[model samples]
Target: MQAVFATTQISERAAAFLPVERTDGFEERRYLDQRQSEYLRMLAELDELLLRNAVQWYQQQGRNADQWLSAVAAARQESRVQSGQGSATRRKSSDVFSRARKLMGERGFPEDQYPPKLVGFTPQQFGLERVARKGLERLKWELERYEPFALSVYSGATREFRTVNAPVRLPVDPLSPGEVEETCILTGGDPFAAGERVRPGVLSAVAGGAVVQLPETVSGRRLALARWIAGADNPLTARSIVNRVWGWHFGRSIAANPNNFGSTGGRPLHPELLDWLAAEFVDSGWSVKSLHRLIMSSRAYRRSSRPADAADVARLDPELRCLSCFPARRLTAEELRDAMLSVSGELNLQVGGIPNRPELHAEVALQPRQVMGSFAAAWVPNPLPAQRHRRSLYALRLRGLPDPGLEVFNLPTPDFSCERRDSSTVTPQVFVQFNSQNSWSRSLAMASRVLRETATEDGAIQQCFRLAFGRSASATELRQCLQHWRDLEAVQREAVFRTPVPPPEVVRDAVEENTGERFQFTEKLYGMDHFVPDLRAEDCDARTRALADVCLVLLNSNEFIYVH
Candidate 1:
């Protein structure tokens, strides 16, 4: 998982495990979490083993659970001494030690449970020991080496926090990981055991500053937020979302990167028009359909993809900065698969429902995938046409099991939201398009479709062009295809083809992890035993075969793939 904080405040759930203070460095000096540290502590003493670097790697530099906890102790001790309570300092430390020890005790782990690599020392004692063993120069050098990672984690924490708190200010220990000592102090049943708890009001204060005001009522709140977001006064929300919709539909946004609108991002070619649309969206009460209508209705949208002036296109608008002509775009990963099925007269346009499992690679189908605490079952594609050919968006089984074919075309991973998809052409994409079973099947299906649409071979040829290219074949194109078909007639006569009826398998199954045993079961594949139209090689004649080749070229052409 690539960890990124869109802004700073980490989620409360994350904050619970890694408190805010641990992330924000302390004003005072602090130590490390040695017991969990890979270098110094004995793993046996810990109740649960954490990959030493896992949490540490996530944490901002100069901070750790141990350091934050130590600071909390120091602060508490200072408070105690200030109040003429010097006698309780050691007692407080001992109390913390006891709690730590008790938690370990409850686990009932043997003394040498883990690596049993070394004896133990608390984080502070270990740090001082390190100072002696490695000298100050070595310590400084090591810190420098790990500084970037620490800073990145810290920045990430801050970014996470900012998402919720929005410009929140919590005092930080630049050198410590985020930790909520107050949350931990409750372990003793003393609400104020950690001296003082962070005020809940801190969050409200931060949120109040950044969030736009909304109505108090539920529906009113949503409406008000919508108004604010779509309002002319707001520059980001409407522009961002609309740009995303356009990019999704057309393959590219007016602005190169849809989500990013910062100065660093590519400038919009039609800034005035974009602003006009944004204002119109607000005026229309943020209706998505309205924006779609505006864009799709424009002459700009319908222009031919071919650029008339290639030299001027390269020179005057080298980057295609000006909308000189519509650029043809390939169908998106989802659209490509869906469109192919549709063109083959085999589409099943069902709407939303539970996701179906489209077929996956045999290797990937059997590969083990992990969920929260256990492994998930291998993927099985939808057995029925209706489920399988549902709109690409409704296609099921999207738990990081991206179709390899789709991924080759830049399908986004579902684990996180993708604001915009990248469309870079690469060699692997060509390989997938040319060689994959899916491609071959789709190709043959085109041939069968052409033959079915027209009775005579010549008529079938014309139908193929009309269906595939959205226009009748030109005289020259038809002539060339006729010649190609004569050659292919002999090739098909010698070639053997089969439409494999895949064996049914238990699509969903259960497995016992503890015992390493597998239990299999099946679920209905939806509309089983129904008449299905598959790509059949036997269905096509010589002329239909020629048209299929022409259709294949059209589908593969750059003109059909890109959108202006």
Candidate 2:
């Protein structure tokens, strides 16, 4: 790729004379061959290559390849325009005129003499009609087979390569004026409608009481808007950012509503503190880490949750406005689930790629989900435990169906930005924490880890405490856990062990929108087919079951859920 770019340049004289001359100028002919070889070598290194453009390039290198390549390029440009890549105003007629002029120029005809109808001219003039048609046919066949290929390009001085799997082809016709107007009507507004045409300009209300001029192009307008927001003279951006960060750490912003700073929002509790933090955040070059360090290292930040004189402080400042103590907060849904997996030694720490399919409740996974004219495939957990046990942050989030456990814990609907999560106590959260298969599985896993790592009951209890609360259990708590375990073990000593039942096949039913007919389809249970089931009461002995029971209780306790 680098070699291709380095060897190409455009000829100014050709650009002046030809309507559509080759933009890429090859300075070194030998370099073009070398780079092509290098590109092929790179493609060979990949597991598979899908060469879309490369096939055309290969055919072009034979007879009058330059003209063939130009036709191919024009086709690709037309395809891009059809796919909505080209700007609205220029995409309609200008691209057609440009291509026609280029074709006429290549044929040694005067640009002015080229008829507008020739914009839809076939590639036969360039002796590429047969090859282009053949290549496109092959592309379609290969795409159906999921075959992949690499695309290659070369012009005056530059060369480029790309890997694509789908078919590519030329546009049939340039968009007519009526078609362009129709598109504008659908997406923006009718250009002919009264008071409907949009003109680019900054809002007078927001532009410091004056209308600010802006360029017409999308990129130019975006750049101007970005500058206005991030400009040093603008006082709101830095302050808003600091407030949001502060809210995340403290569970409440200095200005109570982090999303709204207008007249309707709550007044800042500590206006001076807010301003100072904002100023410091700006001074530190908008470094998030620097701001975090400054805030967290403060003496006020380190204050204990239980102040030295709680009663006195409460009476003097009921709101705790003096920063007397740190606020206690419940862990967010993601944090709670991730923490459980971490403690159970089952967490897959692999980072960043596509969203992972974590195990969801059977009911939710098998539920029928509607899509265009059909029921979508049932939710499938990743086949391997490593993939399925990834952090909750990596879990696939669906708008219609969220993971039930996370939802129970108040994971917000993702349709809007969530400034803060609601932490209201609810019964569903209790059911999910104690009875759900996800919770029981993690508890059993934690139990196995404790027994494997410890020798005695006391040691196992201590290990459980350390994993759950980051501290050893107190004497009273240890004694209570020991007694509970002993009692449970005695009760389960004579219990029979049974293998767990596999999930039932999911049957989804949907009505056809056009035919008014109902149909049912069985969704594949991909995850369960390969799942290595976790240890259950049936799999473990009486003693282990008792320990798992104890672990389950600890997991559901306040100590595991709250952060002070």
Candidate 3:
């Protein structure tokens, strides 16, 4: 845990970006600070690539959980001691500094005027930091007992550390509600009483036909409650999951309101089928994959979305309750984002990894927001294309903030469990889908991919249709698209575009939470010196960009976004 967010491991490629020494004094410290900035900028990349799989890898190597934390710490120490690199550099620098001092003394220079950096630089001691949770809440009361105590952090400007040599204390039982209410609360040596605390206890809830009480275990109450929920006697759990699965496969749920199965919820169209699936779910040990396979293999699921007689089917089922054919529904927010990435050949298939901060709208990415009393830190995306292209399943979800691209498509609020999301067609959805940077960039990538794999411009256009819509274009459609591409190329011929676009390093200003004074901090953009970017407008010629424009049109079409 100590090294989980450690900012000391500099990328190997970063060394090339390190500045060359001019004829100047006090340069060593500046070099050190630059290194500090590099690590900070590489935060997203390192977090995803390293430290993430340490515990899992250790377990796979047959090590215990207790040893993994130690392994992480040892790894950091080993990195610092590579061939005694840190110590060897210090020794070499000292030799150079002494020779300079002697030569200067021979020239009748004052020792007081000697450069401070000539003595050799001392790197800051990156001590153990207690990175608190969002609310600074301890995960468990017992965790405090085993948690590492914080070591001092060196403040470079002031050269002070009040936190150094701090006292440590283990967990103590919190006062009872009655005791807190009866006793006077004191703050800053004065009385500061609070309202009466609500007494804590579990309330009985109605589970189906029975009134169930929460388990009263000394510990593992969560485990006990989970077991009771999935127990043989409880049918609600299986029924609820089965209903949700059916809703995903079809456009609507077996019970229309998947969130609530009570009297207030909508009535089920096929109660017998729902019951059978629920029974199968519990019998198969609650396996979701098994449920998906069973549902997909059915004739109803395999039915064509286009019916032979649509009017007759609509007359028979006005609300689509009969499931006459497969329901043609727009993709969910996640699916829409993933599909675009997949079609562009940019989707990273590596599963179960770090949450990614995807490229967002410029206005949203640069928008200022407060955290507690100070402004929040800027959100930095991972530098590498592979890292940036992770699926939206692993996208970071901030409670109050959201990705604007995903939001226009009806992404649910992160704080709530939304069983249903309305896919309303708003004006912003049209703009984001067609004109947004995300869409344009993806289309550019798709065009580049097709251009590389196919020979002729015709083949590239055909390939775009296949990749985006899963089929070849018809004769008339092909002819129209060909004309469209040529016209676009004519316009693009005169257009000038920038190339080798470098990612930015942000310098953010914020008011200090404690001091209420504004200050600025540099946020390094990792891999800026050696970043390999995706294909852009300037990377391709007029002809290629025109094909890219056609690819963009295909991506914006309904056929690409709907599961018809």
Highest lDDT against the true fold, candidate: 2
Q: What C-alpha lDDT, on a 0 to 100 scale, does residue 326 get in candidate 3? A: 82
Candidate lDDT values, in order: 0.52, 0.63, 0.61
Q: List where candidate 2 sits over 4 angstroms from the true fold.
A: 1-213, 319-322, 497-499, 512-518
Ten-residue segment with the worst summed lDDT in candidate 1? Answer: 27-36
Q: RMSD of candidate 3 to the true fold?
A: 16.9
Q: What is the lDDT for 482 in model 3?
A: 92
TM-score of 3: 0.63
Candidate that would win on TM-score: 2
Alpha-carbon shift of residue 58 in model 1 (angstroms): 50
Listed per candidate, the RMSD to the true structure in angstroms reads 18.8, 16.1, 16.9
Q: If both were scored by lDDT, which would come out higher, candidate 1 or candidate 3?
A: 3
Stretches off by above 4 angstroms in model 3 are 1-215, 499-532
What TM-score, over all chains together, does every model reach? 0.55, 0.65, 0.63
Model 3 is weakest, by summed lDDT over 10 consecutive residues, at: 122-131
Error of 3 at 72 (Å): 37
Q: Candidate 2 at 248: error in angstroms? A: 0.5
**Residue-by-residue lDDT tens digits, candidate 3, 1-564:** 111112111111111212442222122233333433343333323233334443445455564545334434554454446525643112111122234334445657555433332122111110001111111121122122222333222101112234422132211222211121222223454546443422212222435546554433223344446667678767677888889989888878898999998569998889899989998887888899999999999988988888889898889876667778888889988899899899889999876534666776656765666543233434545556777788888787776569888888898987888888787989998898898878888988888889889998678778988999889999888999999999999999999986535446666555444334555555444434444566678878888888889988998888988888
Please estimate how well model 2 matches the true structure, expressed as its whole-model Cα lDDT: 0.63
